[model samples]
Target: MANVKFDHITVRYGSHTVLQDFSLDVESGKIVCLVGPSGCGKTTLVRALLGLNKPETGVITVGERCLFDAKKHVNVPAEKRNIGIVFQDYAVWPHMTVLENVSYPLKKQRRPKEEIRERVMHALEQVHMTEYARHLPNQLSGGQQQRVAIARALVVDSDVLVMDEPITNLDAKLREEMLLEIRMIQKRLNATILYITHDQQSALQLCDKMAIMQQDGTLCQYGTDEEIILHPANRFTFEFIGVSNFIPLRQAGSGLALDCGELIPYTGEVPPQAENGGFDLGVRPNDIVFDPASPLKARVDSRVFLGSEYNYFLSLGQKQIRVQQSMLDARTRGVAKEGETVGISFLNTRFYPTQKGEQTP
Candidate 1:
């Protein structure tokens, strides 16, 4: 496996810049996930890395080899880059059987027939698709077809594997199963993976490191899942990766006063350079603590059963907050009915300046 690097990369279409001065280093034998919203340049960045698109400026390198360098006028073709790509569509030939599909890449290299058959069979067994080796793509289920596609990519023994939302089409159960299988395969092969997906859960589960991008193709934040969750670099990154409850507040004497017209204690110092006007207090749903004896009160607006937990929507006068708890005690957990008053406290909270009347913090 080889390390991949992007240095001051820029990609544009007409006058619109899709990616701007983006740079990232992906270490060898590690899984890195690229995550963002629908219009974000996640896909564009992956395409560029795969050598499908050339950047207008900057350079891309896989180990010591320069894949793209504008000043040097060097551009490596996609097929010559030796990178494997698993697209969301599976990209399997309908008429080809599983074995033939997996062996196609070996055929391109003109390997011996026996060697090709051995590699293809081993790859199929790796993905547990050996039982259906002779089955056509049309005869396999979506999950089986996806396995065949993975086996095809694996058979070539490419060092770098790029998968773009490969499991997005599967059902919840199948998606989980596929994720486990993929993780096992990657561990066994020690392959370098660059995964692109909008699903936060998938990224959190699979990626060793992750980068969050904006619609303009700019890198917002790149870090471990824990770092991004606990210490978000910006307001946008905070809301996108996890659930956040925004409580409007204004600076008071030494603390901050809730827009609910109540004063709440703060444990940390708010920056003096903070913008004027209202500020927002961010609290995760799981961080909200409920106590029957506390003074701060809220009424239960709604509650929903979520299998392992119960989601509660609590209303404090005109403001609404969400809280989640284990599904152990139906009496205590479910006791808070609609309009029932109860005390509330936050386990942790973050502060940020309000933006455009929205509590992005």
Candidate 2:
């Protein structure tokens, strides 16, 4: 397995900067997911890693090999990188059989016929597609075709794997299945992986480390899912990764007081990089408690039952708040009709400043 690193990477299109001073290190055998909204340069980073996009100023290294170095003016071609890439649309040849598609990489490297067949069969078996070796791309289902793409990527035994929205086209159930399957295969092979996706749930579920980037090419945060969920770096980070209720706050003595007239105890300290105070309170939907007797009151605007839980959208004046609760009560879980008044309280919350760096209201 190989580790990947980018040193002060800067990518630009003409005069517009796409990525600025981006640096990251992915340890060997670890899976790192890059997630953010569209136009956040997620695809740009993927292209750069595969040597498809060259950075204006940076050094890219995979294991001991330097793929791109701006100072040395060295650029490695994508074909020679030996890195496996799985695209969102499974790029299998419609005319080729599964075996032929999987063995194409070996053929390109001019491996012996016997070795190519052995490796191709092994790769197909790993993805449970051995039975469909004779099937053509057009004959297989969407999920089956994706499996072929994965087999092709793995057949080369590349140390680094880059997947860009690999499950975007699959159904929800199939996506979940593929997620587990890919994770298991990666662990078994100990391959270093960089997964790029717009789905936050997939990123949170699969990544050992997660990175959230902004539309302006700034990295909002980088950490484990738990760390980012518990303590977000700034307002954008909190809002981008998951659902959050941003309650307005104002300075009250040493602490901050919410617009609902509740006082949050003072912490007496803030991030040194933050230039302001009492910006907003960020609380996840799951962290908020729903009770009929709490001091805070809100009207339920809408509700949706999601099998095992209920998601209630409440309106606190003009602010729309969301709360998700487990369906413990079969009868009462979906009983909250629209416009019903309900009380709410926060269990876990964090304060975020109004401005961080160049971010504004």
Candidate 3:
């Protein structure tokens, strides 16, 4: 319903700076997941948008409305911003019934009782919680309580919504259910949502676009899940978004080599740029394949059948790398026993500078 933008935003806490020149755009009527490691300023960004934390410098906007512009000296009050937020705790009043909780916002605005009832039921129906409107928070299941919180946000008729780790407290099964519920509700409402979380799995499943922030509070990369997974902007994006194995690289003779114990020659085509040292070969677990003819070898430390796939822990010199095989692949290639020596090769391999804090090639 509205596009949210943070332009050149910088937030500081006393002597320490939390974010510097941070910028992000959430397209109208789309769910953008802002994901990062803990304490990466995801919540701080949320606070700034909600008018709870004032940024040291920047402009915050909802569609055409200028919420905050430091140079312009315009900062809208939190309640007047008309932005809905579903907090992590669900924060439903324990004493209030579901109907009461959903209608609280409208009641605060002092809408007519008839109009409040009409809108309250409509919001409850949107979340499929109309049947339990009279039930107290304790009487409803975790998912139901979460629905109540969402309905409360919707009751305000805010076009943009911010969901801050809304499903983290639920069990895995319920988390999945709530995620689906949220997605369906978002689509039905055509709501512009900024979903914040540290769980990459959920972020991958729920987001139309994903934004990855590093530990230092800088946004590393932002794109669709496929773009971030298959074409990472740098080493940090590759290592953070998915399971990654990084092996130090060295210049071996005429060709590049992987330092997996012995200097196993890498026959894969290398970019002309990697002729020098200080690069690490990065590969995903699924990309590591078993090739009997390949010269690279690793000892199988263990094999686990995890229902859908077989996981292999392999020792390539002193370091270990994990390989995942589909059930069909396992049947076709046959399972390798523990302590068995097998030839391995990397597919879709990437090279990154091994220096810490260095993101790019």
Judging by TM-score against the true structure, name the best candidate: 3
Candidate 1 has an lDDT of: 0.83
Q: What is the C-alpha local distance difference test score of candidate 3?
A: 0.90
Which runs of model 3 end up more than 4 angstroms from their true locations? 252-256, 261-263, 356-361
Q: What lDDT does candidate 3 reach at residue 356?
A: 70
Best lDDT among the predictions, by candidate number:
3
What order do you get sorting by TM-score, best first?
3, 1, 2
**Model 1 misplaced stretches (Cα beyond 4 Å):** 251-256, 260-277, 327-335, 357-361
Better of 1 and 2 by TM-score: 1
Residues 169-190, candidate 2: write the lDDT tens digits.
9999989888888898888888
Q: Model 1, residue 238: displacement in angstroms?
A: 1.1
Note the Cα lDDT for every prediction shown: 0.83, 0.83, 0.90
Worst 10 residues of 1 by lDDT: 268-277
Q: Which stretches of candidate 2 lie over 4 Å from their true place?
A: 250-278, 291-293, 327-339, 355-361
Name the Cα RMSD for model 2: 4.2
lDDT of 1 by residue, 267-299 (tens): 343456443437777888888767776667888
